[model samples]
Target: MADNLNADLSCPICIDFFTEPVSLECGHSFCRDCILNASRAQGEPTGSIACPQCRQNTARLAIRSNRLLANIVEGFQRLWQPQPAGSGATPAQCQLHQQELRLFCSEDLQLICRLCWSSDAHSQHSCTAIKSAYTACKANSIQLLQKKLNEYRDTHTATGLKISETLEHTNRLQEQMAAEFAELQHFLQQRERALVQRLRAVAESAVNQLVENMALISERCVLIEQALEEIQSTQEQTQFLREIKGILQRCDLQTKPALKTPELHLGEFNGPLQYTVWKQMLNIISPAPVPLTLDSESASLDLVLSKDQTMVKGRSKLKEFSHHAKRFSNYGCVLAREGFTTGKHYWEVNVESIDEWIIGAVKESIDRHSAFALTPSNGLWTLRKWNGNIYGPHHATESECCQNMNLQKVGVCVDYEGGQVSFYNADDMTHLYTSTDRFTEKIYPFFLPFPETMTKGVLKLFHLQL
Candidate 1:
């Protein structure tokens, strides 16, 4: 009621309690300054102006002061103002009995007057002095607040410890990164020296061959010059003829093919230099992709495995196989043959055109015969695509998993010690989701072709060339 009354008293233009309130002939009210501004905004004469609310022309001087509304607004303001300190608060009273409520009714959880406490309405109910009830209520509130305060303080201390632990871990990672980069730099330096030396050795051999050819030509030229001089200066025709024959033979020997210039090839050092080096660097890098193959013994009867065990597809008809306790009897799920208890491992699965599939890691010891929920608490950390929608752990949707890109092939990476399992779009290496958990035992890669009869696409393990 107060809010409505306040809204009624407020000026339409100023949106506040009217200051020097005035009313136009159109029945709309506004502050004196607000109406004056509106009149000027209309760019009309002061004697005549349009009413801002109704857009009807009216004489500015005809506006009347609203004394009643001004008084009501002032009274409403004072009514809600807080009373001065030491002013006693009003005590509760029984509406029916019209008496001070000094008794408490335990059964009704209400305050009652003395007369009502004795009446049949509350005769069987336990009653206590309101003063005693107030004391007990205050004590309980204090106790509850203390308990919450202790809990919050303990949480604060634990958070501080976590912060310290994270900082220490970050420092260790920095040291490791620096050491690894130093090793790469050393390798690059040695490779550079070896390549440069090889090039220099080829250049020297080519230059030496060219120098030998030049020396032989110089000797032949000297012989030819001597032969020319003997032919021109000789008085005996027989001697000149003999020397000419020897000179011609010398020229023929010099004309014989000299060693071809040694071909110098840069091989991979010419262009796309960085890419070539990076490809070679893969040979030295650790934690390469794991070679994961589906375990045929662990596959469900409704699923079929390829000869290489790298692909799995739903079976049109159930296949007869030796009963294995490790096989998933309920769900069309298959565990990888290799399991990891420690260290980081990465692998990719071709999920292209596959509508429904579940790919991730599962605990080695999880129940194989029963259908289990895809969640960390159930010993499964997985990303699933079902009914055209992708889901992460706990059935969270694709948006919740922060999947902002298309997925073709799916990449799964697990860091056992770091307690993290991450999924990605293998085509572009875009991260899709990550789940963290403290793993206690061996975990194996798992795949599900899903919907026994509906899905037709096969899930193939992608082999990494690096």
Candidate 2:
């Protein structure tokens, strides 16, 4: 049973039964010291030992001390200390060094003899003094592990701080952005309210103006109807008088009756009743004559209209004029003098030409007052002349003439010597109302259709009907 148990026992290095154990490439093995010692004696390094049986090397310098084996050997040596008188006891020897091992050192836990220590192989090597090297190596390894742990902890702390700071900054920026958005919304709302209020005010003013214009136009229509009625009545009276006159002419007063004769004489009605009535009607509707003397003294001529068809002259010149001035074929016509013996004279000019023409009312007539005598090269279009009156549609009445009135009916007039052409309001002048429309070129001439009743020397009157 003991032999069976021993069979299972193993050498620590080979982890197998100790039989011819050999050293390894690292010079560490079991039962290879004797071969290693012999190799060393042949000039091999002390640590380099080999096994003859297995041809393996070992570190001879490493002390191999087996505690259990030493205990068993000691027990056996004690039992055999006293022997029989004639019996001989064999001494144990180290197979590696071929020497006896006498001492067992507890400090190194190695078995050694005095001869081995004194031998050249181990003579210079220090004897086993203490076992503190193992404890020191273990302590140094623990310190290195602690340093690595500290480095990892510091790195983790720094990374965490950066993450916190980034989050805080992001939150602050988001709050600022939100505040800006709120302010922008408030500003837009305020502007919107202001704009709405301004638009309302403008709309109200426009509506009031429109209402006033309607009232004025309605009054004008009533006066025109009354004038027509008066004309019809005058025509009827003149026809009656003509019939009575014919009857008187046919009756013979020479043949006399003998008893109770009555003397009858037909008196001729000399006055042209119809013509007189028509003339009176015309005067009522006609624009009031602006006196030449007054016109000359005043800075400008002001023309105002009443519901009774009376023209009132105010202190200001016609605030507006017709827009078709550029279309007049006779440029001189625009400067014609009003209230001339010829009749009521008027002309038109383009809106663009007004600034170049005589601005304000004529204070004094220039020597070359005739519109025809004025030439385009002389810049006479920019000066006032005596031939005609310039009028705008808006200036037909006071209420209609607004500073913001559409420029469509504004024009200047020039009247020269004989022939005259007057341009009235027309649709082609629509461009003046908007800034986007550009006037790139000079305006051409436009002629007014003359009425047959208007004699060559007589001035013609033109009015805006619509």
Candidate 3:
């Protein structure tokens, strides 16, 4: 029992048996402070009192007291001290309640004496064998803390990766935007240069047009000044002519009394005065020349009329017609026909009788001249000279003259007064189309000659085909 008591008694610093006690780096020791202090003071700093066990230099700072270790040491010392006899086994007591405890399990987190288990505070709490609940609660708490720490570390790692990816994507997009902006700026500069060039060209053209117009005006002014000078010289010559006429009259009266009254010879008044006056008047009255400044580069030819033969009319007498080239003979005989001409033909006539002239292409010569008063009817008036054309003929089955005749027959009839031209299938007198615009001015018509007959004479005697 004495040996057991000695084994439990421990040093305050090392918390073990006090067998070779040595001081620590903190200067607290059992039996080695003298040798350690002596060794430390001999070398390095004179006041260096480093402990031999912990190797701490105790010269700079004071040693701190180990309260927990001191308390445990004091408790162990009290337990080793002598006690009175007949002390019955003192029950373990709870520090909080000051009551004797019958059970305690350090491993199970439970401290329940019989009295505590019966109390309301500990009735629902888990209670195990002595010292078991405390160990279990500590182990469970450590596991829970470790799980939470691992989860926080994983979350932080994932967030860091996402931030890095987003930063990389932002950097790429910024670079792309900068490159696109540079290309756009280059394109805009090129367009600006082209526009400036075009504007300069337009300005130069405008200046050139202005210069041309001014030059034309200057030439016109010079012509006007020349005209004015001519007119002034003509006026001076007219004044001289008047003075000479007065002198001639005085000589005639004075010489009449002298003899066989010499006749006053009035020489012809031909002079530059008359010519200058005439030229100046002509310059003032003549029409200015028209500028044919058409920009032919842009002209189009979509609606131009095709060139055909010209036609002219005779005035009155048949003898007067002989002066023109003998083109064709108008055989004085009129036909009651209406159709388009296939080949080119020309003829003219003077109306000797006042008859209703149904000149345009029609199905038949109807006696209904009253219905022809309308503008676009069967019987159209010839208000002015006109030219017409007939397309190729195909079939004709209507009129009697074209019932079974050759189908390749067409005719074109022109009228001057009515402003009308018509096309027809001459075999059946079937009118096809008509036009209203006329050619009133004189024009020579074209004619295709037949090889069968060449007889030609005045209007009294001429050749006929049908």
Q: For each candidate, give its TM-score against the true structure.
A: 0.68, 0.23, 0.25
What lDDT score belongs to each candidate, Candidate 1 first? 0.80, 0.38, 0.40
| Prediction 3 global C-alpha lDDT | 0.40
lDDT per residue as tens, model 2, 132-222: 3335545756887898889988988988998998898789879966876676556556545664665666556666666666676566556
The C-alpha local distance difference test score for the whole of candidate 1 amounts to 0.80
- Off-target runs (Cα >4 Å) in candidate 3 are 1-140, 176-200, 222-235, 238-466
- What would the per-residue lDDT of candidate 1 be over residues 1-466, giving only the tens digit for each residue? 8767767876665455677798888888887876786577557786887887788877877889999888887887678645567988766779997966866776787888755755668857776666556787568678989999999999999999999999999999999889889888987887788878978888888888888878877777787787677667887888877777776675575565454566667664577777777777777666666778889989988888899999888888776789999988888889999999998899999987577788999998899987777789999999887666678878765336543334679999999998999998888888888999999999999898784644668889988774
Residue 51 lDDT, candidate 3, scale 0-100: 56
Question: What's the ranking of the predictions by TM-score, best on top?
Answer: 1, 3, 2
Model 3, range 238-302, lDDT digits (tens) per residue?
67566655544533433322112222122312245444444543333212111111111111121
Decoy 3 TM-score against native? 0.25
Residue ranges of candidate 2 with Cα displaced over 4 Å:
1-164, 184-192, 228-235, 238-466
Preferred candidate (lDDT higher): 1 or 2: 1
Q: Which is the winner by TM-score between candidate 1 and candidate 3? A: 1
**lDDT, candidate 3, at 340:** 29
**What's the candidate order when arranged by decreasing lDDT?**
1, 3, 2
Each prediction's RMSD over C-alphas, in Å, is 20.4, 38.8, 43.5
